[model samples]
Target: MTRSPLVLLGKIWLALILVFLYAPILVMAAMSFNASPFYQLPFQFSTDWYAKMAGNQQIITAAIRSVLIACGTTVIATCLGTAASVALFRYEFRGKRILQVLLFPPIAIPWLITGTAMLVFFFAIGIGRGTPAVVIGHVALALPYVIVTVSARLSSFDVTLEEAARSMGANAWTVLSRVTLPWIAPGIVAGALFAFAVSFDQFVVSYFLSEPGDSTLPVLIYTAIRKGFTPEINAISTIIVTVSMAVMFLAARFSKFGGSR
Candidate 1:
């Protein structure tokens, strides 16, 4: 069969889009290794920036805190968002639409507004700013992402398997735990990883919520950048970009929707 002109054009368009998106990252990664202090270099290569980043204890501490906060937010958001998605998709419930909309406001709201609201809410509730505040902020921010991802997976899911389990004397909880969970496990896992990455890379929320010593990696990077645009910042940025790409690639690879089985 001969391909149509429209199909050929569409393929070209997609290829262009992919190039547009990934080109900058490739350039940034390359520049991270440039030995020159300026963007226009004598083209020398060095690992000095990477070494400096490795020696920066503050960045390491900030990264550790970011991991801890991201883990907490991922756990909370994944559980709540997955449960909400499963319930909404699998069962008929009253006010389900309203609840769904409520869960998604964080995505709709501007990050600045969300950060301000979180700060206010935390203070009003007498929760002092720190990891606790960051946890709450990241959880709220990531819940919408989790809900969207899992719900999309569930939308394409086969419910007959769940019904079969129920007919075999499995209770609602049993069906969910055994049948439904396995089918959508990839989506849940992917969403959880995305949520963790979002929390890990978060800057605005952490900036607003964190105490003096509770800076996340992004916040630390920002502070470092403000001090001066050092080559070490490029190194950190390259590392972060590399790690994020690896994570997202792995998440997609493990997804059943991606045909990994």
Candidate 2:
């Protein structure tokens, strides 16, 4: 058809973009199961790398620490972000726009600059480099994302519902707990997932903040690659990618994008 050319071109561009985004991940996943340690082709399949990964105590310890940090970041980020979103949405004040604008700098600034800045600030404050420092950086990085997600959800909320609850003699806490929170539950879930993903996948900040004996998965992976590339790297890379994708998928399921609400 005469009109089909533009549609075909759009489809081709989308396919190219997807390949650009996902090709490396696909290749890494493929290599994880390959028998060759050197990333050789003609693909003989094996599970030895994963078995080796499982047996590595250092990797297991790092993985647990990563999960714990991500969980902590998620909980703190979600609660604070959801509350901030509500306050921002429910009230109007001078410099409120300025406050909202401030959130963007953390997200927009280069991670290298942010990471170094965090190190300097934490050192000045005596926190220094460690799990606490990493959490502080991760929460700062993740807070904006959670605020944006929950704010987007809150944009569709009806103010009259809160007014009606207040008219019925419900207190501030009662109205928020019974009305606003129920409506924003999906957004909170999605925001929490985003927080978890951000912290779990973080590298630069964690690299600067984590002490030598302890590191998050991404930081650990970077150190391993610097030493040498191995199939075990591929195995862990595949797992990280898989787990991150799974978290985002669940986030999508809980978001308004999923058509649940």
Best by TM-score: 2
Candidate 1, which segments miss by more than 4 Å at Cα? 1-20, 254-261
**Which candidate gets the maximum lDDT versus the true structure?**
2
Per-residue lDDT tens digits of candidate 2, residues 1-261? Answer: 566989999989999999999998999999899998888889999999999999999888999999999999999999999999999999999999999999999999999999999999999999999999999999999999999999989998999999999999999999999999999889999999999999999999999999998998899899999999788888988999899999999998888664635
Candidate 1: Cα lDDT at 258: 51
Clashes of each: 0, 0
TM-score of each: 0.87, 0.94
Worst 10 residues of 2 by lDDT: 252-261
Full-model lDDT, candidate 2: 0.94
Candidate 1 residue-wise lDDT, 55-155, digit = tens: 99987888788888889999999999998898889778799889887976788777889898888988998996888889988998999888888998898
